[model samples]
Target: MLIAFFTNNYKPFVGGVPIAIENTARMLRRRGHRVLIFAPDYDGDVQDEPDVFRVLSIKNFNNTPFSLPLPLTLRPAYDLDTLSQVDVVHVHHPFLLGMSGLQLARAYNLPVVFTYHTQYEKYIHYLPFPQQMTAELAIRLSTRFANSCDAVIAPSSDIRKTLIERGVQVPVHVLPTGVDLQKFRGGQKDFLRKKFNLSAETQIVLTVSRLAKEKNISFLIRAFVRLCTYNSQAVFVLVGRGDAEDDLKALARDLGIANRVYFAGELVGKELVSAYKGADVFVFASTTETQGLVVLESMACGVPPVVVDAPGVRDFVHPGVNGFMVPEDGEADFAERVLTLLDDEALRKALGAEALKTARRWSLRQTTSKLERIYKSLSAKGQPRGKRERFIMLRELISYQFEKLLEEVDKLF
Candidate 1:
């Protein structure tokens, strides 16, 4: 089967979404499927994956900060002659690339599948509009985009539930972003700690995420400061960088934990793997994630997570099993949970062991195969029949009405 893997960003523009797409595409190709990636040109050398095709040279918009590509001209390769050759169009994001893929699929009369990767509504705080308005717009846009696809794949049950609540009539499948087991499991703990200047006695509480407002790094800083009251030897290492770096640094200073917090900004490869292995506890406070890929990476490294009991994290971190889930924004509870894991070596070991086991369940091969099955199922059903097509058309009309209503509301306020 020929598969077109569409995404907003790919390679060198590192993130969970891109990584997941790369892994799935590679695995699918290995399974003897012809795969092609449609993505924005990041001005990097293309990888030499025989079965994978790269379509480049598209113009990018909002190039600063986020580096999102705003496609100026979109023509399906060979006037969608090649697109017609593909059996299914699997889009990883709901924005530009996904929209392009959806349009091409419609033109070519091909089966379309979409993966809901991010929680767009949670990130509305970063937008220019008011939070309520931004969230409503996000919901309407996401619902419309998702309803277009024959099947929607969500990384967690929480995301699926959110889509259903938003009136998505399409079938939603719960799939997780898988991790590389070999890269993260065991070994080199002491060497990693020594390399990072961290002592064996130091309790390393780590977080790896793009430094963005929606990541809620402020909450992590506040909670870490509170945790310092119980454990002075605690060290906070933050990986990744973004607009919030300065604000976070200032917050750490104000909390009087500047000396304890280390900003290890934007690490990859061995450095990233080592950081995960060296940590005593892996912590995440982001509420905007559809799936927390870092949580799985940390778990694969046998580092237990102290994450919020939200959508994506809950799917991986089971309280008293692999890791503890504190209530969202519950700074006191977050601090206490970290302290509990840090102080108790026995509990940490038990949780870490179980976390490794749990991480095994979400392998790249397993996830890709499941996605393949869904794609095949959709392909077998072919295009929507008379009543089904009408139903979809009606849903699209309702979605447009909702979008107009949101626009009017925005204009009013």
Candidate 2:
């Protein structure tokens, strides 16, 4: 099968959506399928990648790392002839390239699949208006986009439930991005300790996230300060970098935990795996996750996470079995749970064992097979856009574009 993906961001940009797209495409190719990607061009992005297409874009928007794609027209980024042969059209965001994906599908009479990757409302701080206003606008636009698609892929059942509640008429599939078990397993346990030159007795509490506001890194830092009172050996090690790095570092320093916190920047491949393995416990407090891929990665490396209860996170966790899921609030409770795992090695190892088993169910090999089935199912029922369907889509596209313009204006005030 041939699949075409229209995504707003891609590799060298650093985010969950890009990782999901790249890994899924890799598995598809290995399974004897071809894939094409259309994404915004970023300034330091590696050139000449296979089966990838780039359109004009502002590499940074308002001093932020987000690239604003300027596709200019519905058919700007894709080739008419190549697009006609694609079996499926998959889109990762609900705007920009995502809108373009829907347009191409409508024009060519192809089945389009939309993935609900992020909780749109949580990250609307990047917009100019009050969060509530921008959030409402985000919901309306995303719901319309999902309704127009042949199918919507929700990374968790909770997200699917939310989509249904929001009046999404199309079928919603629960398909979380799976982990590569082989790549994550059996990482060198002493890797981080040796790299940072820490004593073996020192405990590492790790989190791999893009240090951003929506990630709730500030909350975690506060909780870590409280945790320090209980365990003198514990040190917080954060992986990944973002616009919020300076603020987070400042927070740690002000809280008098700067010496106890380590910013490891970003690590990938074997080093990333080792970082996961080196940690005694994985900690996270993000309430705005679609599916916490890093949680699964931590579990895959035999490090049980003490994460707060959130949408995508609630699906995989079995408290007292794989790992502990703290309440939505309360730093005291969150700290106590981490201390529980830290103080007891046997209990931590026992939970970590079950975590490895849980990780197996969502392996890349299994998820890829599920993806193939989804594609085939859609293809079986596929039909070209009839006159009526074309009319409806064309009208919806115009409305969507106008709404987008209104949003830009609203940002100013």
Candidate 3:
């Protein structure tokens, strides 16, 4: 099967979504499926991945990191002949490229599926519009786009539930963008110790995430500081670089724990593996994640996580088995849980073993095979969404009428 993925960004952009798209595409290709990624060009540096078609885009349109694709320019630049050969269109974002892919899918008479990758409502603060208004608009747009698709893919059951709640009237599949278990499991690296100047006796508590406000990273830092109050030997290693780096560094310095805190900026490949493997336990506080891929990655490296309980994080964290999940309200408890794992070597080892076992279940091979099954099922159905087509058309008509009515009402007022 030839699957074309339309996303806002791709390689060199360090994030979970890109990682998912890249890894999933690679694994699917390995499983005898051709995958092509349609993404905005991040600069002149082209990715080494084969068959990635980059669109012309304007950089730094908003205060956000994502580059906005110039759809008019993109249309001309796209290889429509090659795109027409695609069996399935999978869109990872809800705007720009998403609309373009839907248009392509219609023109080619191909099935288009959408993945609800991010919590758009949470990121509405980036826009200049009113927060509530922007969030509602984003939801409406997401719902309409998702409903138009032949099928919807959710990274976790939690995201699927959100999509359903937001009025996505289509088949939703709860398929996580799985981890590359082998990468984390077998790699050996002495970089973490040498780079950070840490001794064998130092206990490393690692957390890998973008240093963004939405990540609740400040909360993690506070908890880590408290954990240090109990376990002086434990060192906190916060990996990944983002906007909040300076603020987080100041917070650590203010707490007089700067020496104990190591901010390893944006580790990839072997460095990332070393960070996961060198850690005694993984600590995360992000409340906004469709699926915490980093948690699974850490677990695969035989490092159990002590994460604040959120819908996505709960899916992987088992209280006593693989990792401990602290309730969203329990910040102090989160710290204690980290200290517990740091203090008890035997319990940490036990949990790490269980974590590795759990991580094995979410291998990329298994997830890609499941995705292939979804693709085959949709393809075998011929018209793909025959039953839902009429319903979608009717819904669009009603929506059009409602918008017209609202516009006329506004004119009167």
Candidate 4:
């Protein structure tokens, strides 16, 4: 099958959404599908590849926090030209690029699939508008964007539920964003520790993510400070870059734990794998993830996680099994859980072993196979039966018409 994978960002730009697109494209290609990625071109020259296609020249929107690409124009000509050759179009976000993909899919009469990766509602606080009004507008836009697809994929049940609540009428599948198991599996812990300048006696707790506002890195800093109050030998390592770099540094100093914390910005490949393997525990406080890919990677490296019990994250970490899940804002509770893992070597080993086992369920191969099944299902359904027919059918599905009709006899109550 010819599949057009669309995204607002691509390689050299690191984030969960781009990683998902890359992994999906690679896996689908390996399975004998021709996958072409359609994305906006950044200032730097993107390598030309047989399957990768760049359609627009975009500019960097913000210099701080992170670099976001804003397209020079909203014209659909580029997308229509590239998407005309594909059997299916899979869009990876609800941004300008995704809208273009939706338009092209409509024009070509192709099946469209969408993966809802980010919670734009939570991100509204970062914008200049009133938070509630902005969130509402985002919800309306997201609903329309998702409804344009033949089916919508949600990385976690939490996200699926949110979409349904916002009146999305499409079929939603809970597919996890995956990890590279071989690269992250068991390895030389001592070598990694030494490479990071840590002695065997030091306890390492790590967090790998972009330092954005939604990540709530300040909470991690506070929790680390509390951890250090008891265990002075514990070290905190942060991997990844963002606008909050200096703010996080200043927070560490204010908390009086600057000496014990280290920020290793955006380590990838073997270095990133080593960082995961060497850590005794993984800590993440972010409430903005659609699915925290780093959590699974850490688990694959045999490192247990201490995460907040929030959307996207709840799908990965199971309390008392592989990791601990604390309340979203509970810094003390989070620190206490970390301390428990730090204090008990036997418990850590047991949990880490189980975590490795759990990580196997979310392999990239499995995710790709599930996606293939969805593609075949949509294809078998055939071209949509006109706009009105499609809209009525979608409304019936959303209204639970069959179930409602069956229960109508008992509605007097």
| C-alpha local distance difference test of each model | 0.80, 0.86, 0.82, 0.80
TM-score of each: 0.88, 0.92, 0.92, 0.88
Candidate 2 clashes between residue pairs 3 or more apart in a chain or in different chains = none
Error of 4 at 285 (Å): 0.7
Worst 10-residue lDDT window, candidate 1: 385-394
RMSD of 4: 6.6
lDDT of 3: 0.82
In lDDT terms, which candidate is top?
Answer: 2
Residues forming the 10-long window of minimal summed lDDT in candidate 3:
385-394
Q: Which stretches of candidate 3 lie over 4 Å from their true place?
A: 384-413
Across 214-252, the per-residue lDDT of candidate 2 in tens digits comes to 899888899999999989999999999999999999999
**Which lDDT tens digits does candidate 4 get at residues 309-400?**
88878987899999999998799999999999999999999999989888988888888899999988776645571121223224434555
RMSD of each: 3.9, 4.1, 3.4, 6.6
User: Which is the winner by lDDT between candidate 2 and candidate 4?
Assistant: 2
Candidate 2 C-alpha error for residue 80, in Å: 2.5
- lDDT of residue 238 for candidate 2: 96
Clashes of 2: 0
